[model samples]
Target: MAKGKVGKTVESLGDYLREQRVASRLSLRQLAELAGVSNPYLSQIERGLRKPSAEVLQQIAKALRISAEQLYIRAGILSPDDGVGGSVELAILGDTGLTERQKQSLLDVYASFLALNAVSDAEFAADGDVAAEPVATDPPADTQDQDPQKITTEG
Candidate 1:
């Protein structure tokens, strides 16, 4: 990405973070304390003077009771498409009942399923059947010439 675009993304992320903090009714110092960061650092982040790391974003998201993926996307750390199954991941991560090992196992299985589906979709597209099939977007040429009143319903 261009330097200008990166700067804008960081600035937007900071704006978003500040909005969330305000919406959550938390003071800057309170949010900084909750996120385990210094007050000055949080202020710098809110002002778009600093681009925080993924870990810091995660901490801030947790403190704000929001999805970390949203922050990651705003921070340009992850693309929107990359967060396709984010809700599932978030659910697994947020489940306090599950042990760390169980969460990891579930995440691994989910990732494998997504990977397998992606490969299957790619293979299907590459098989030439897609190109050979007619796209059913428009009526057939014969149907286009037919009168609607003359058409019979089999049902």
Candidate 2:
């Protein structure tokens, strides 16, 4: 990432963290204790004077009862698109029972599903229809006698 971008990300992440902490009604020291980090370290993070590691972000997220992926996005560690599988990815990463390889495999599979859905959504959008009905076609021979008012297309 560019230096400027990184700086902006860190600053925004700090601001977001501060906002979450305040919204949770936790003081700086209280949040620091809950996150198991030093008060000064947390203060520095909130001030945008330090870039925290992923582990730290997770801890803070847990303390704030928010999604770690949100922090990851703000920190520029994960793109917004990646957030489609945010909580699932975090669970996979945090699971101690699964080996790293297993976690990676699961993540890959999950990502493939998200990608496939994205493609389908794009195609649907390109069709310029808000509904999911199929293209119009001739009525079946057996249904030709049915009243047109009784016919319906799936949405």
Q: Highest TM-score: give the candidate number.
A: 2
lDDT of each: 0.83, 0.84
Candidate 1: lDDT over CA atoms? 0.83
Assess every candidate by TM-score. 0.54, 0.56
Error of 2 at 15 (Å): 0.4
lDDT of 1 by residue, 65-95 (tens): 9989889778765556645647776676667
Write the residue-wise lDDT of candidate 2 on 1-155 in tens digits. Answer: 55588788888999999999999999999999999999999999988889987678889999999988888779865667764557777777677798757866887787789889999989988888576567888888978899988988879
Which 10 consecutive residues of model 1 have the lowest summed lDDT? Answer: 76-85
**Stretches of candidate 2 above 4 Å error?**
1-3, 86-155
Query: How many clashes show up in model 1?
Result: 0
- Candidate 2: minimum summed lDDT over ten consecutive residues — where? 76-85
Q: Report the number of the highest-lDDT candidate.
A: 2
Q: Judge candidate 1 at residue 85 and give its lDDT.
A: 46
